[model samples]
Target: MTSPLLVGFLASFALIAAIGAQNAFVLRQGIRREHVLVVVSVCAVSDLLLITAGIAGIGAVITAHPQMVTVAKIGGAGFLFIYGALAARRAMKPSTLAPAQNGSARLISVVLTCLTMTFLNPHVYLDTVVLLGTLANQHADSRWLFGIGAVTASVVWFFSLGFGARCLSGLFAAPMTWRILDGLIAVTMIGLGISLVVS
Candidate 1:
């Protein structure tokens, strides 16, 4: 028989491992080696709070208020579209494609972007609150332990994605590589934004 903790860990990891706007942003920052700790911390802590809220039954509250999700979808879509356009522009400019030449974003800007990427996406709510919470509650008396397991998965994934990206510095040394990355990011952000609006 599967333990609640293991179930939670596996479930949470599977949900977040997908490439999304949040993950794309984290990957870029990790490649740049800029504000990686801040980005990782924000994502992990946000997951911690969200997973806790889910286990505490806030998922039910959110379910009762469908408008909240709608609002997030619209706002997140707009944000992603703009970010995607910027990334596309960057990808087109070879001068801006080099990691060393690409200037670092201000600390405040990184924090805000990270927060926006985390909280503005309705999918985050659906995954962490609705899905994870529902999964945790299925374990009955062991629900909190399930939640702890989920939170651990989140912490581990974000840190690994954020820091592990640094090892790719050698690969990203080429401006062409950065172009390909930014181009992919642009496509991903725009594609996700469009999906959010229609879905």
Candidate 2:
């Protein structure tokens, strides 16, 4: 039998795995190996809070207020489009291939950027609060367990993405690697932005 915990873990992992603004920023920070602990902590905690809210019926509240979703969509779409353009610009630049270790942005700047990316993105709310929350409600008996599982997934993913990314240092040593990554990020962000606006 498929346990609610397992269902939550798998479902959350699947949705979270999608390449979005948060993931991109996380990946970048992971690659740069700067303030990773802080970054990962923020993401995991943010997800936990959002997931808890979802399980607690915030999803329904959100559904009842379509205006909130609309605001999120507009804000998210705008942020995503701008982020994508920045990625696209980076992809065009040849200097991106160089080691960014010393060039890492200030901790405060990075954290604020991370916060903006996390809070401003509406999909996070929809996915964690609405979709996952609704799915957990289906299990009624073990909804909290399901939330725990989802929370676990977030913890594992962020930590792994942040720490394990160092393993890719060799592969990403080349400039082409950065180009490819930024290119994909750019395309993904733009596509998501357009989707939000149109949908």
Candidate 3:
């Protein structure tokens, strides 16, 4: 039998490793070297809190209120669609890829966008709160350990994604490459948005 800690780590890793809006956004920021620390911190901390909440049984509360899920889905979809449109525009008017842009964005805006990406996405709740929580509870006495393991995976993954993206800096130096990446991000966000609404 798999240990609960290992189970939790692997489960969380699998869910988060998939390409999605959050990951794409992180990669973009990481490449740009813009607020990478803030982005990574927000994502890691948010995951920690959500995972802890799930283990502490907050998942049940979320589940009990189905309307909450609907609200999140609609709101998340709208945000994602708008974000996607913005990305599409960026792709169309490709800008030179630089480590830092001419003028950096405000810290507040970056934080707010990161929060929206984390909290608004309904899938995040489903994966971290419901699925992970349910799995952790299956461990019975070892549930907290499972939660810790899951949180560890989240922290590790985000830091790696956020920092590791710099290795691709050389590749993204070309304006066309930046355009392609933005285009891909746009597709991913819009695709996820559509799925959230239809599902």
Question: Lowest summed lDDT over 10 consecutive residues: which window, candidate 2?
Answer: 96-105
> Which pairs clash inside model 1?
none
State TM-scores per candidate: 0.97, 0.90, 0.95
Task: Give the true-structure RMSD of model 3.
Answer: 1.4
User: Which one is best on TM-score?
Assistant: 1
Q: How high is the CA lDDT of each candidate model?
A: 0.93, 0.87, 0.90
Using TM-score as the measure, what is the rank order of every candidate, best first?
1, 3, 2
State the local distance difference test value for candidate 3. 0.90
For every model shown, the clashing-pair count is: 0, 0, 0
- Report the lDDT tens digits of candidate 2 across residue range 29-49: 888778899999999999999
Model 3 lDDT per residue over 51-110, tens place: 999989989999999788899999999999999998888888744334444357678998
Query: lDDT ranking from best to worst?
Result: 1, 3, 2
Global local distance difference test of model 1: 0.93
Candidate 2 off by > 4 Å: none
Give candidate 3 misplaced runs (Cα > 4 Å): 96-102
Q: What RMSD does each model have against the real structure?
A: 0.9, 1.8, 1.4
